[model samples]
Target: MTERAADGTGVRGRRKRPTMLDVAREAGVALRTVSRVVNEDPTVGSHLVSRVQAAISALDYVPDERARQLRRGVTGTIGAAVRNLTDAHPVLGAIDHNAREAGLTVLAMSTEDEEAREREVVTSMCRRRVDGIIIEPISSNHQYLSAEVESGLPVVAVDRPLSGLEADTVLSDNAAGIGTAFRHLVLHGHRRIAYIGDHERIFTGRERAAAFRACVAAHGGPLDGMVHPGAVEPDRVVAALQTALGGPEPATALIAGNAATSIEVLRHLGAEAGRLAIVGFDDFLLADILRPALTVIAQDDAAIGRTAIELLLARGADPTHPVRTVTLPVTLVPRGSGELPPA
Candidate 1:
């Protein structure tokens, strides 16, 4: 026996979705009158609007927004392709907040930091004909988006630029953040400082590691066994820590390249974390609560988000506008960890 619906229909028990025709029939009005009422045409009489609204309420009608948006030749929604949805993403939150304030909707999808997944998610968004797109790009080659872009689709890249594509981009000053972290350690009387960060294959990791090298050169500090850039995994971070701290000329201070790497370094250091002057590149939640609270170079997550939306909207408004890249600044927050004397 087939399962029955709440209305006891015989054929698979699937209830048909109420349509505008049903609403019009119930209201004793023509189909065109119902359509005009649904669209909120200014010329529709108040009495007819009331009758249609009552019929709609009686049938619990829910309009198909996608259909209406298609008929209007535009969707009031934008798509956001981000790295991941599992972690706390302040930038994504800001994007959603700003989008709502602009009378737009955000449809977010996670790419899991994979190149193939980024392509798939972005392609899906394009197929859905979203008004615009904001992406935290992970792919090495975004030429896949060329056709859509050429066809006037607005795209904005956040945190990193789109490879092989010219589009609007928003970025934090990665090199400056690293420089500030290095200088902060030097000011704290640390002559021998080591840097550990994300893999150099990543854009941020490359910029930050290069900046650290520049800082070391400017200070005439030893570069040998000082810069360690690689994956942020536990085993790799532990090995890098050991190498940075175990050399004949061990470093007295350290700069973690990113928040995850900083956490891994702190976890490995345990109670010994206070013995070394440390500054992380990115600020994270509860960083201030740690013993000898973590010092960090903090990125402006809100500005990045808001700027991305602004660029996206601008592109949508005028596709012929010049492609632009906006780089925001970072701040150094002094805490106990980065101020420790060389030990």
Candidate 2:
């Protein structure tokens, strides 16, 4: 007997639908023995198991994943939310790749840098009832995340720590990275240093700015020339740079918050790029190809992504485990631009 699929493709006409019964018959074993072999049961005798497995393979038998998932009470799907996907953000790519490798489907959504949209996306994922969630939280309120955690769904934060949420997190050491950049500038005889960054509402930006202040204070340097916050847009950052550069005693060095900020600083420092020293957090492509090249604090975005997914999956497996916060280290990559003397 045979069955045909909707497209007239032979479902069983070409070859009989191979089953465990067929494997048992071919191996001359009981149905239970075939089941044990198919399940890779450790109690099964090695010799008999090999025989049944060979028969199953020869018959092209396949296990039903949907049935397995149903029996396990899991959907085999994970939901992930990020700020943007088009940036080829290394972290997002890693999480997506790792989740797929672990046999979990990923539903990705972008918040487009909007907090309200972030909440909407998260709400949609919750309605879909994903097995777990990995979020790059757009806002400081962890209340939104608490709902998921309380519902027994595992949630992992990536890149930034959740402000009020008690959940597992994977992020780079933002404070340490900023401190290193500040120290490097100070070591180069830059007493009047300027800090330019994003809004303090974000954990990363806040930590970086705080670290810069602490480092400068420790060296008896005045913090009077700090630029306005939340200058991610190029125009805004350029304006801030102009204001900082026109200070009473212009800043001898500038510590940019991240890659986006670095772009603006570079544009403002064009032509005389090698004159004013600058150090940026987060390395970007072709950093070394710029006129004077750029020095940066490099975070392992891919590593952060991979670690967050693994942690989320582990938590999903055992929700009762203690919550952990994993902070990865950042590296300082010195280049010609950050080493320049005061203009």
Candidate 3:
């Protein structure tokens, strides 16, 4: 039966997966012969092999690799636990590409930024005996993974360090990025720069917010309603915007903490966004097309991805080697918003 969505619209079900039995029937051969052919048995008659190969080509039958890997005792698979798989994920693509180059396949799962889900997916990957795991950690305490790490399961963290474990970590230079944004705004003659971002519980959020504070302190600016770090909801962002722009010490410039915060600030400002000098941390798609074009600090994603795979392989080869943390530098892309004179 066809499935229907909650709205009563017809929705397609999963495609009917072709099976080995289907291949055997198509080739007019026994199921054991099909399995032997798939396993590349040299003793099988060449004619039978050719016939099975032809059937495989005609039906596009892809043999399951996991069962074979189990028999061989090494999966040659690494698992990736990213924040979301459904969203735009350039980093995840890079990781996959690099892993492929290393003769390894990647199994990616989404954590949805939930600690419980992260743990569940990672544990599931372990149960399947993946060779290694690369994680964008979200949990407050990852003591659960200590056992796996101790047992020599190669684990590498991307974007944030794993809690309660000393594993290989790859991070963007958050402090340098924030400093670049702050200086770019300051060079344009703006001293009262406001910031709004995610709650400090998140690693990126904490690093960015702290970096912004350091910038403010170094410049000796009044830390009034300028620093607002909390949930990324619409209400919280709007409230922060109001506070920064409404007070007697209203800010003439803004530095957004992340890509999401940059978007929220732009949405709230609308036409007025042009009047205020702005610099954002983390460039996003279409940032160049926005009015006055957003200036941002962009991380080197390709390098980060490649380096992550390198670290994972290195850890696997020599577990006794000292664990390493790599912090890649960020670049500043100035379009127009960040260069505007204080208004």
Task: Name the best candidate (by lDDT).
Answer: 1
Ranking by lDDT: 1, 3, 2
List model 2 lDDT by residue over 175-246, tens digit each.
899888888887787878888998888878888888887887787887775645684987888888887778
What TM-score, over all chains together, does every model reach? Answer: 0.78, 0.76, 0.77
| lDDT for position 159 in model 3 | 91
TM-score: model 3 vs. ground truth: 0.77
In candidate 1, which residue pairs get closer than 3 Å at backbone N, Cα or C atoms, i.e. clash? none
- Clashing pairs for predicted structure model 2, backbone only: 198-230
Worst 10 residues of 1 by lDDT: 1-10
Poorly placed runs, candidate 1 (over 4 Å) = 1-75
For each candidate, what is the lDDT?
0.85, 0.77, 0.83
Model 2 misplaced stretches (Cα beyond 4 Å): 1-75
The model with the greatest TM-score is 1
User: lDDT per residue, candidate 3, 178-234, as tens digits?
Assistant: 898898889889989998887899999999999999999999998889899998887
Q: Residue 243 in candidate 1 has what lDDT?
A: 92
Instruction: Tell me model 2's lDDT, rounded to 2 decimals.
Output: 0.77
Residue-wise C-alpha lDDT for candidate 1, range 1-343, written one tens digit per residue: 2232212223422456687778889999986787777767789999999999999999977544333332332336788999899988889999988777676678999999899999999999988777678999999999999998986678999988999999999999998898888888888899999999988888888999999999999999999989999988999999989999995789999999999999999999999998988999888999999999999999998899889888876665545568999999999999899999999
Instruction: Candidate 3: list runs displaced more than 4 Å.
Output: 1-75
